[model samples]
Target chain A: MNKGVAVTGIGVISAIGNNTGENYRSLISGKHGISSPEILETIHKNLPVGEIKISNESLAEDLKLPKNHSFTRAALLGAFAVKEAVTQSSLKIDNETGFISGTSVGGMDTTETYFKDFTQGKTENSRYVRAQHPGFTTEKIAEHFGITGFVSTISTACSSGANAIMLGARMIKAGKLKRVIVGGTDCLTKFTLNGFNSLMILSDEQCKPFDENRNGLNLGEGAAYLVLEAEEELKGKPVLGIISGYGNANDAFHQTASSENGEGAFLAMQKALKIAGISSESIDYINTHGTATRNNDSAETEALKRIFSKNLPDVSSTKSFTGHTLAAAGALEAVYSLLSLQNEQVFPNLNFSYPMKTSGFMPVTKLKEKPINYVLSNSFGFGGNCTSLIFSKNGG
Target chain B: MEVKIYINGIGSISAQSGDLFSGDSARIYQENIFQAISPNYREFIKPMALRRMSKATKMGITSAKIALKEAETEVPDAIITGTGEGCKKDTEKFLENLLDQNEKLLTPTSFIQSTHNTIGGQIALNLSCKNYNVTYTQNSVSLETALLDAQMQFDEDPEIYSILVGGVDEISEKITSFRKLDGQLKSKSIKNLDLLKEDSTGTITSEGAHFFALSKEKKQNTYAEFQTLFIKNTIQPENINEEIEAFLKQNNLDSEVIDVVILGNNGDNRYDHYYKNLQQNLLKNTMQLTYKHLVGDFDTASGYAIYLAANILKSGKIPSVLKLNDIDSKTPKNILIYNQYLGRDHSLILLSAV
Candidate 1:
């Protein structure tokens, strides 16, 4: 097998915590971050969300940006996550580094706020007009990091972050660059709040992932990043984990809903296992893409059954802790997966009391300490994009 | 060992035609701001699923079906898509409803579809081909990014036989109007046929979906062999020549070997210099071609360029409408497509006649 991509460093700012250590503490303690909307100014205040407690102004101030900075909430979160990743990776911001970011709504937070103002001759908010496109958000992040080479963005819904990681690995394997930082960021907005509300998938209660009474998902906002480096370039660094394998597949079944059999999820898991040169039994834990929606939990359970047969590994949906962070979900879960491997722990799938009737699979509802080696993470999104990423301890 | 990836099958839904093979024979739209002739999406997608799909998803699914049919492949090893604006219809719908309703009682469907990867995800959901699916949205290079991913899959494993790849974009009323306000779209409507000659400051906005079934093994229906694809985030007009030279040298080919050079010129006076710089210098002697006049300009418009290149390579015949220069070749053998948007997301794609 090709030498796996080295994940030298990671950074995260999610609802559960900020940065790697904080998030790990929350995950291990089974502290669910779901709370009634505090930061997001929305009419549906009853709906729970995994919102970062920081305000945009506070974030901007923390980044030490100029007062007249046009950075959107998405960019702000992205900058924070990326800054942490860069510092953790200890890589100099030079011409050689590449930045690939995944974002669903690049600057919708600012655009939504400024859309009508532009018609009223508000030139100050007009700067956000160009930021609506996803590339502009990534460009802003690249600019902040002083990166000028191979900068790009991927916008594959929830799987965008995973796909970004996959692309970074491919670029490194192709000998394109020595180091690259890849991940995704998204700031919850009234646009997404109402968008998901219209679909009637936003649960009023804390999201009960894999629970029989699970109503729907709680939308969250945050950013997470992983710094992936070539093996030779990672000399003497603390390798957090290794991105052993990654697979992406399309459900091709519907626009938003996954298939009954979870074909895409199954295929992604299978492909990832193949790439990692491991069997289903070797996977010690699974970070499911269980949004607690009736469709997602059932479909994902079925997929797990198909991949693992009778002896499935301990599985949990961290969405209970962080909600569904959309594009950041993949990277967030990637960070959690690495933490699980590092700590040899199995995080609880909060609010899950009963298994879904279809797959009859139950999640690990209590934190358990064990010898964890390999962890599989799944993130599926609209347009039936399914991605599975396998992370393993070094030399596992 | 390296594997040669071939364009086994192709499909598209644009201003030209929804059918891949039939696009060349399709009627030429002379209007500048042409919209895609949407197919009967209900025939392909179920109502429950179709209710929430935006124009981008519908176009993406329909074109993906056509591509799969053309290749006669039931399932591909991977499904990857590139989109620039991604699910604009839903994005607009959600935004409009939010602004109009004051962010009350909105649904999740529009927001879910608004994600750029939704088209790729929806296609995967429809096909149940859960292999390797990704969506790239790097401005104009969105489609090229997907193509590059497909190429990497082929290079990584020869066992990866077939990959479904495409680029899609859609225009919504509000977004299109705002784009016009920002001078991204041409102010005046001009005939599509006269797009090149028009002295316009911006491009006529349009949308399209182009899907291709790429495989390592060339089949009877293979359109062309995708040789190499390159992308650069930024390029200056002065550096265009050097970039092209270096790109060709890295690919172990030269300008003389390229039979056709498809340029992305959308009648924008400001950025048209990027194309003019190429036409006047490095590729002056090459048989130049252009297509945005017919399809208008969008992020993934380069997909249509790929469609055009594939057709020329397959038929060995150049349509009279696409000719930008009189430099003729006996038969189109090698093709190079270069595209960008607002002078960013620069991409170069090379296709060879198989």
Candidate 2:
């Protein structure tokens, strides 16, 4: 059986920064991207969000597409990220390259805009009729890169992107595809803005992860992708990091809330550590999915306590910087984790003032330079979907 | 390297009524376009939790519970699901509120439940099973994709004892209207039993949830063994026979050895030709049967066909209502299911009686 999958290339677009370099620079500099919504036309303007400064029109222009193209903001961001990853990998688009993308909102941006118009007998924008479907968005990305083999989309809420990467690794291990590009993308929309506001989870101030004053998560928009290749395909390509282990588990607790004990997160971390064939102490850092919400931080803290009895590694939530990018959170954090491994540095959980009274866990408050070997990234989404991914400096 | 994955238990909540394991006899709607089967979810879910769940979540959880109960397993190794338009009811609710409220004071319950993975996540939460979770949303091939993932898990990890896999799809008024506007749904309603006979332009749309407990270890209740599955984004009508032959060959089986063939023949005249081609050339002499007529057509409707094939293999009895032709067989063993939507997302599933 294959030992490990090589991560050859990476791409990202988040509130902290657009490209990988900008994101990394912002991470160590402790720059927070959370702000009031300016681009998204939502009544929840006071609510904090990691809104991208660029407009959809400008994103399309950057991609050099026709003016009347039906590319949704989600598609535009996804294509941009995938283009970077593919270019960096130096891989040709052919039948051998597999495209696996994850998204929760798909084309909801376009669908929400045209929902009423379409019903009013307006036939002007029928091109987006199928955009609401998740598969349509994935197909757009696949077609953009001229990829024709084994394309699929996963829609597991926030954990979608991490699951996509896990599936790509399994496919490579199965010898199904020689090269695979896996990641996730999502764009801010009034649909999600109002959705989170309705749930009363949108924080009014900058999110304070793992802090006693934490309120809730701040929604964000962006896309991130990674190109993973089989061992033989690696040849002389510089490997960024090795995807050594991954796991998924369901809490089956509630539709929108996590359980008190963080059962799903605990199981997912346990399974991932088992798959990586390493002890908990081997993990030097953890990029938490800490959305700074009451339910998520507590549950995740409990999960960590259960998984690593006494020796929990340095943990921090980068969502403090980029906000919670829904489907792209896992991928964005993955890129950050690889960066941490390469630079042997840990990004601080900005805006944290005090530790939570219940969990009594404190995240890395300031940027710390340390020799890091393995990093565990966690992402949990609605419907109790929890996923954990472990990246190692060397092939496990 | 070759490991056998068996369907130990099956559960479904579709237009046709009945709990998991009970044949589709308690309630079967005769209308072409029927609503989903409503279950007393209180038994499986709490009232507070039930209040927030959409039709997709309720159906998925109830069916998953039934499947797990039948298999007598408390926790599964993984939870996987597939849906085309997931949580449509919530999607519509949230969208309506978004436009009506003009993006003000909208609650997150509907929006949170509206994601495609909500059902899978809910099932995982309900079972407290945290092994490996994934969801697929590949149009008509959604369910097949979930099945393929389960099969891969079984082949790769022998420790994975049981995996809960299912597909769900629901219809909402706005999306349904849009589909009708797009000429996707049938224009005129016909009897559900007579869907195939109607030479219409579109197929009847419906919703359902089908869950199966798949494992590497076979038991007495094991329904059938999943052999292989293949999905193609686009396939020409002329290439249908060649594709089937090649797939069967890869599995070391030939067309003549197939005992039964389940076809997805929704009343859509444009795309029904794909099934007709297979019926006429590839498996013309094989025992042909169909189920979309019984339980309208949807993205994951082929899941119903898999349920029926599994039961048929287990009982060795063919229901008269599902028979498409009179090529009778004393004992049906190897079964192949072919399904596609709008001439795209073609999928082939092979199963054998355990």
Candidate 3:
């Protein structure tokens, strides 16, 4: 039962890149994707975001969807990413194959745009009426691949992607599924832009995750997915990495703010390590949930200190490059974690000059090549949802 | 090492009151859209905290508390919730204000509470249970997804004994009305009790929250045994009989052994045939029951069916209002529930008397 779930392939489309190869290139090259909104029609032009430059029309056209299609931005991005993963893995879509997607806003972009028109009695875009549900986005991607089994969507805010991956792994482990496409997708929308803006956490510049001088986070839009298959299903397929363990916990502290002690993060990480049947010392790299917000960074640092008291693993926040892609953050980071393990290198945490004074823990500021075996990725979100996943190089 | 899971307790806040399950006459609503009969939230939650919550959050928390209290469990090992259009009232409010104010001068209160996981997170906060918590938002199968996760949790961890799981969905001003524009709701005004009687294109819409406290160890208050459940994204109408047969066969049970079959027939003529096909063929001889007629249709409307199934198994009483056929059972042993919405997200759940 402890046999690891094999990650056969990974796909991602973030602000920095449109595919896994491009994302890896941007990550190691120290290129950040944070920029002022270009395609997203948000009034917060001053706010920086990891906005994908591709427009919805082009994405639909590229996907070969009809003009009357109800593909929302999130659905479009999700399909765009899933197609690559399915192709890379050479996985056959069948009744046994399942699809689980994590999304926060889901199709909110389409809803926010067409809401007024619908209320004013417009029916031209009524196809998007049910698009607000996160499952709609997932089903769109599922429909594209003709997958008709065990489709579900998780919406635990920012940690959604990690939770989705975790659920997929658990399902495979439980023998409920043999192969499943699992990940998360979200796109920039006026609703989320203004919502985060209302929280007063929108950083006007590139996000500086875990940096002492970090002001806030830059919201990003993207989608990422991993093809997880059981050992029996992988006859000759190349394994990207192995999802050895995963854990989910709630802070139960506050609705929005994390606990000061990072209790949830600590428990989640500890649980992941226990599930992976390894000690904390075995982890070679840590992909932090470091959203660069004051509360999150400090709490996560505290959690890290508790877990790795003496020798902290080479830690970095890839969100610095992708600018906290919300629901897609964990899947994007999962792909990055696989990249780190495959290349035997750790991606740098961009824009980190100094650590917080309270917790003077400095993150890896430059790309470092090393013998990486185990990678632990953290993803925490609103509603105090915290998830941690352990990826093993040797299938554990 | 398989552990038996039992439904220790159930709490529901739906269109009809609790008395309906106790053989009271059903409340008739002549409208296509209805809301849950809210309980006194002050009894379950502090009034100060209740003021800021949306109906979905209030119902979820209160119902969860009810289930936990009934189970005599202080804190569960995990909490999982499935919701469709979570906190839509708050989401709509935040979106409308954001648009109305033209991205100017907006508060974060509504936005903060609008998240899909707010109910699960809030239940955790209220209980101070820092254990595993998650939320699923998969349309009609949301509750089934949570149940599937809980089932997996039991298989993975021996430490997890009790889990609080639920399905919730609420209506909003702009968002719920959008269903009418999209033909997801009946165009004509229909009575709630007459939901299944009318030949309609869309089912009546409503909001509800149902919570179940599941435990590995059965207690005196245990309702029934949660045998198993299956969820599939899509299936052909013609293949449903075979699907049910396959599921039953997988569990070492067949139609003859089934006592009561709870169907999710919401009166949408286009989709009702799926249930009609099953009713005439596979489950024709079985005692048929339905609950969406009593509680208006929503994504998690099947939660009511589960709640009803548990209660029926425990008390051995088949509420007359839910009977789809005159087939009677003095003490039903097995209950199988099959539900779907708009011809997608089909689910099958099996429960048996303890």
Candidate 4:
């Protein structure tokens, strides 16, 4: 372990890519994954989303599951990403390897499909009843990997994945576990699509993060994981990067909306900087929470100006590519942050044309190669849960 | 790096109401489902806030306040919570409206309250404690995860003083009824007091909230000190005793040193054998206690056992109503709490009198 909590390996499966390499390629090429609804059966066909082309059947077949498998689409996506993470890390999942996952809609895909059927006397798929719980998907993943220790799931809306990573680092720093595989996964369902639609936050067009004319965010689904090993457990292993600091704070202003000044966002960034033992001037890049919603972009920009002052780092919101993946957005961006560290390059924020009038800030519109040292990624969610994770280059 | 963790205060709301240690009344349960005998939520929550919260959020906030007041702490440094089917009423409302309206014209209230961390977030907002807030939702082990995180908090940070850790779940119409179809509930109504006598396939389903004010510094009214906590995702029911013995050995305590052994027994004929093996063998001579008969079985029902254990430690007295065996002990110094759900998420927690 070079420094901080060592991040040994990472894996991701999203609309833009199915693995880390694919995601990196797409990120460098500025390939936005936004498209019109193709798989989801909804009334609004014009709504754009970052939908993965693969079907649940293909995902199940990839895992060689039986026909009567109770694994939900979320669990399948989680398993797919976890498998790649395990392979990349070559880490052994034993009694000591804890697993922590973040998920919003754990298995709603299965529950919504069979809720009426089971309640109306159909009992063939009754095993899916427990899928209503978010922990169900985590249980599926833990069982798949044969992990038996300290398994937990966090659901703090969109900031869930970042909080999961935060807890993992805290666990390691506390000397509770020697190693852990932490991440998050969530699959799109009618429940969330309609939930966001009802909130009137779902955009009908491709999301343009940090753009002045951005109307709303496009919902997406995916999963990602990172292997974090403690100092004692790291014996000359290939470390991707080090998680230097993480902070979580609540806005306490609204149930679902961010404050105009982004108080929670500002506090979270300050706490992270203090924990990392660094100053704000050291952050080479910032992966903002920008969900393409007007409120989020405006508030986050104000928070950025407050934290970084006039000299803001090269900031971009990756949601322009992945369309806010809810719980998985944090970890997905964490992987992107690590990719930035390893390649010494900054990925551009796609689809951003105009700058917001209030903040008068522009996200990096083109990919830039630079000497990256540390990157800060932000994930804000409903209930005013704001979390920021800072990743430092291993040798830096 | 492990440090001593003490249960400075405790609060619970279930079929048995008020302070868990206080002798409230002759508790009786006639229905299979045990709706919590609630306190006046208005006393703990503001009028504007209480209107939007669901049953789970209301119970969680109220119980958390009771615990904090008992500990005489105004605001905890951190708030950690565990919930399985979080905000069930709001989830049901949102889902029902979504399906009924074909996903149109639905308000964001229910959707906003539908997340698993609503209770934890609401508690933090109510207290305005921005230290560290997290929520765990791993089925039955939800509360255990929270307590473990609390222990981690105290262990990692030298300055963190106190934390509010809780486990809560709520029951709604559609979700509870659907659970019946999944073979998670008893086929017929069984008297709550006679839960152990029946050879039933499933146990009764219910909900409640339990919160604890845990601190590194023990006060005169400290309930108990946490010794160790462990979890196993899956262990064979037949080999549960081995797990318990191993956990005890690792903690450097023998089985005989345990004055009270709290077991989670809900009379599920399919899974009660795990408890029977422990009660009849290793812990036969110790005072055995059961509480699901009074609290009903929920995801975080084991939290009630911790509340009971802490009271026994603080008062040096065990209520006769909770006694499963007649083992006599003047003071219970060490208590072991073991719980599992459907033979998964098995956990063992050891506590000692401060």
TM-score (all chains, Cα) for each model:
0.91, 0.93, 0.99, 0.97
**A56-106 per-residue lDDT for model 2 (tens digits):** 889888888888888888889999898888888898666678888889989
lDDT of 2 at A169: 92
Docking class of 4: medium
**Model 4 agreement with the true structure over A1-396: per-residue lDDT tens digits:** 125799988989999999999999999999989887777777777788888888989999998888888898889989999899889889988878989999988998888888778758688888989998888889988988888777889988899999899989988887778889898998888888888887888888888898999999999989999999988788899988999988888887777888899989999999899889899999999999999998999999989999999989999988889988999999899999999989988889988888888778989989999999989999998878999999998867
Instruction: Encode model 3's per-residue lDDT on B84-129: one tens digit a residue.
Output: 8898999999999998999999999999999999999999999999
CA shift of A348, model 1, Å:
3.5
Say which prediction, candidate 1 or candidate 4, comes out ahead on DockQ: 4
**Runs with alpha carbons beyond 4 Å of true place in candidate 3:** none
Most TM-score-accurate candidate: 3
What lDDT is obtained when candidate 3 is compared to the true structure?
0.92
Residues A18-81 of candidate 3: C-alpha lDDT, one tens digit per residue: 9999999999999999899889886789999999999999999999999898888999999999
Candidate 4: clashing pairs of residues: none
What's the fnat for candidate 4, on a 0 to 1 scale? 0.65
**lDDT by residue (tens digit), candidate 4, B1-354:** 677888888888887774545665436677777688778999999998888789999999999999999899888988889998888889889888877788778888898899888998888788876667788888999999888888887877788889999999989988777877777888798888888898978888788999999988889889899887987778877888888999989878889999999999989999999999999999999999999988899999988899899889888877777889988878889999999998888889999998
Model 3 docking category: high
For DockQ, the strongest prediction is 3
* Candidate closest to the true structure, highest lDDT: 3
Clashing pairs in 2: A198-B106, A198-B107, A198-B108, A199-B108, A251-B125, A252-B124, A252-B125, A252-B126, A253-B125
Per-model fnat list:
0.72, 0.69, 0.84, 0.65
Candidate 2: Cα lDDT at A70: 81
Off by over 4 Å in 2: A64-68, A358-360, B18-32, B39-52, B191-194, B197-200, B236-238, B320-328
Model 1, span A1-396: residue lDDT tens: 435788888999999887888888898888878888887877888888889999989999999989888898889999999888889889866545778888888888887887787656455555677777888888788878778667778887778888888889888887777899999999888887777777888899988888878999999998999998888887789999999988877777876788899888998888889888888888999999999898898899888988998989999999999989988999899988998999999999998777666666789998999999899999888767788999999877
